[model samples]
Target: MNAALKQIDAWQTSLAPTLPTLPGNDIDWLAQRRSEALTQFSDIGFPTRKTEAWKYVATHAIAKTTPALSQSTIVDSTQIAQWRLDDCDEIVFVDGLYHEGLSHFTANANIDIKSLAESFEHSPDKIKALLSQDISDANDAFDALNQALLRDGAIVTIADGAVVERPLHLLFVSTNTDNSVTPINNWIFAGKNSQCNIVETYIGADTTNNLTLSRTTINVADNAELTHYRSQRESKQAFHLAELTVKQNRDSRYNAYPIALGSAIARVNVEIILAGKNANCTVNGLYLTKDKQVSDHHIKMYHAVPHCTSDQLFKGVMDDSSRAVFNGLILVDKDAQKTQADLSNRNLLVSKFADINTKPELEIYADDVKCSHGATIGQLNEQSIFYLQSRGVARDQAEHLLTYAFINDVINRIQLDALRKQIAALIIGRLPDSEFIRELV
Candidate 1:
């Protein structure tokens, strides 16, 4: 067998002993599902560059390491306080296990928030019904792996006709203690006519090479509104892969913002399905990488019903020998008349060796649909830099300003004031002459 298959077999061997100890192991349905998913993962193994969906990023570093379970590391509130948002309910997970001691969230009648293990143990029937659902026609090896080892995560459910005044934040932290791997599977249900905002952040220490495989399944009921923001900041030696699949009902609105930074290799996949008439969604993203880091984003927006709409905007900045990839697709079904879809990807390279590969596609089977897609890859305009330099700005500062401005288009879409400012500062601090731009941004 090849090296990739051998690596996967090793992982399966290591993972077998721990399956019976998981929360829902005794449930036959759940056990069968886990077994099936594990078999699927074993058959496919780790994705290689030959995989069309993962052509730009590599998995050798992650596959070579024997996967171990994540353990808690020493991290004080002060170290992570900056990542939190004020006036919000928050839950903290350390190494994939819910850390109730460090978490703070008020009890509300209209919402139910609990860890996946706890929820499964309390009500296995409901959890089983919901967890059994997956993306209709998508087969992903990471997602299958996540299912095979899924033990703990978060479940957020909003009551019908309820409006949550405060946003909900889920923080997943990986300590820099060992070469461990964490698989997180989250399920979110928004009731009819309900409204809520959610923020999901994945962060790791700078000293470890951890692997985080996470997948979020969101079900939006009719006329519900959900705004989601996800940010990733991993160590230079770490590998991160995340998948977000959202299903929207009639007259519902879903907006998502994803920011990627700080990892040797990171890939995010987002799939949004408009399953009901008049459902709509917007996706905005930003990624910044330096050194030998690689960041990638893939998006698929499907309009399966009439009168649905979607818009996608993604931007990236690369320096040193870092590389980035963006692939977005907008699909309109045969009966989906009056569908409106748009997609755009823009990238700016700050170093001569930095590279970007972008593709924006449109697949429409309906004649009445309006679909458009485009991608732009280039460096900072010298004329614009000269214009700023002529106005007393130094060359380095001018370059920094333009680069900051290029990424700000996506950053500005963040609705939360504190999160937006913090992300802007983080992005600015990664550029040359960052201090000067920090105060200016």
Candidate 2:
């Protein structure tokens, strides 16, 4: 067997003893689903460099370590406060398990929030319908693994015609003292004509080496709108893999912003389906990696119906020996006439050792559709840096300003004011001339 297959074998052996005790495993259907997922994962194993989609980054380091389940530990209030979004309803999960103590929410007639475990126990039928729906999960190893080991997460449902003004925050925190892995599954169901905003944040304590595998499913009914934002700031020793699957109905709108700031290896796979006519989807993402970290993003936007629109913009800033990968695909079916799609991936490298690989692809079967895709990888403009330096700015500060300006476009797209500022601060702090940037901003 290959190394990837061996790793899968080891993981299966180590995970077998804990399977019976896993939450929701007692349910026959859920158990059978988990088994099927495990078998699928075993067949594919981890995606290695040989895999076309995963060619740029290696997964050997992650495969070498076997992951155990994470346990709850004491988390400081300061750490929690740092991640809290102002004026938002919060659902806190520590080590992939929902924590009642740290979570805060109220009973709203128009909105309902419940833990995934509770939903599975109380409304198995509803949960099953949502769980059974898949958007390319079987084709991905990490997503299948997440399905097999999924434990707890938050599920939010917005009532029809109701508008939620405040954003709902789902915070996933890892405080693992040892090498472990946590798999979380979240669902969002937006009813017809309803509107809501969701913010999912992934963070970890210092020097955490845990692995987090997350899967999110979103369903938007006709005329509904969903603004989704996800940010990941984990320790450099940690690994993160997340898959987002979304299906939008007729006349619905969905906007997504994914930001990656920290992690040794971070990958996010986003799949969106415009399943109904006049549906619109937009995705804007930014990833900043320093040291030896690797950040990868793969996005697939499908215009499944006529008169649908989709747009995507992804940018990355890499320093030190870090590497980043961006692969985006826009597919328009033969019958999807009048479809409009655009995709752009741009990267900036700060060091000679840093690297980036980006590919933007479009597959259109309808000649009436308008689809455009492009990819760019380059350094800062020398003329722009010279102009800043000539204006009395220090050389280091000039370079920092140019780099910050490159990513500021994506930052400005964040709808939440507090989140936008917090993300800006985090990005500024990572630069070499943070003090100067802070003083200027």
Candidate 3:
């Protein structure tokens, strides 16, 4: 058999025995869905270079590793203390399993929160309804595999016309270094006219060589507003793959900020559908990579109705032999008139050997729509660095300053003060003379 086939066989042989232990396995409907997903995954396996959406990046490393499903690891609160954000309600997941002892959040009347396992036990009907929804338009092998090995994740629901005063933090940590894979599925629903902020963070121990597959689905009701932030800081020896899907109703608003800073091979796919008129969304993202790491971001904005607007801005900074890819598309339906959409991707190659591949696309069937897309990949201007050096700044420090400035635009868009500061500190720490630059910022 070929390498791809071998990988598929290995995965099926290893995971088949554990199917009975998965959450909701006992539910006939859920079990049937899982079985179908597993069959689909077995048939397609992982995507190869021929797959247009995954053409720019290779998945050979993941196939070769073929990490098994992750098992729960004992993690103490102090072990993840540094990752906790202030003034936020936190939910912690270790190795894809919810850890109630490590998670602390206050109960509020306007919002209801539960783990996927809890929902399976107490709210199986709701879970069945969500899992049975149609996602054929964007479903892939990775998504199927996540469902096949479904585990625990957060489920958030905001009451209609209510406002959540504090941000909700969903933190996932990986401490297993035995070549394991963790699958997480999160659901968030913003009721009509409701407002809330959510943050999803993925982190790992330094020596990990694990893999994480996470999927989050969100729905914003009429006139609702949601601010979502995602941060990926897994171990440099690990692999991370994630997907985010959002659907908006009339006059709903969505603001997204995604930052990628770690993982040996990391890929994130984001899709937003404007299902109702007058929906608006803005996405700003940044990816910083060094050494031999790889990062990829794929985004799609679908304008299905009239009078919707979308704006996307993504930036990347690559150093050493690191590589990054950005693929963004804005699609407007034939009847979606008066749509205004724009996409921009800018990348900086900090080292001669660093590389970046960016593609910004627009497909509009509407005649009266306004749409634009562009991409730029280049190195920092030597003249700008020369000017900084002439101003008494060292060469290395000048480069660090310019690099930091390149990603600060996206960082500045984060509205959460505490989270913004924490992200800033993390970014600065990655550059040379971080202590010196910290004083300037």
For TM-score, the strongest prediction is 3
**lDDT-best of 2 and 3:** 3
Candidate 2 per-residue lDDT over residues 351-371, each given as its tens digit: 999999888889999889888
* Per-model CA lDDT versus the true structure: 0.86, 0.88, 0.90
Q: In candidate 3, list every pair of residues with a backbone clash.
A: none
Q: What's the candidate order when arranged by decreasing TM-score?
A: 3, 2, 1
Give lDDT tens digits, candidate 1, residues 1-441.
878888999988887677777778998888877878888888888888899998888878878887876766767788778777787788998888888877898888778898998877899988877765666443778778788778888999999988998888899888855677788888889999999999998887688678888888899999999999998987888888899889999999999998899778899888899999999899898899899999988888989999998988888888999999888989899999999998888889999999999989889999998888998989999999999899999998999899998887789889988788878877877777988887676
Q: What TM-score does candidate 1 reach? A: 0.96
Could you say which candidate leads in lDDT? 3
> Taking the tens digit of each residue's C-alpha lDDT, what string does model 3 give over 348-392?
999999999888889989999999999998887789899989999
Q: Lowest lDDT 10-mer window, candidate 2?
A: 129-138
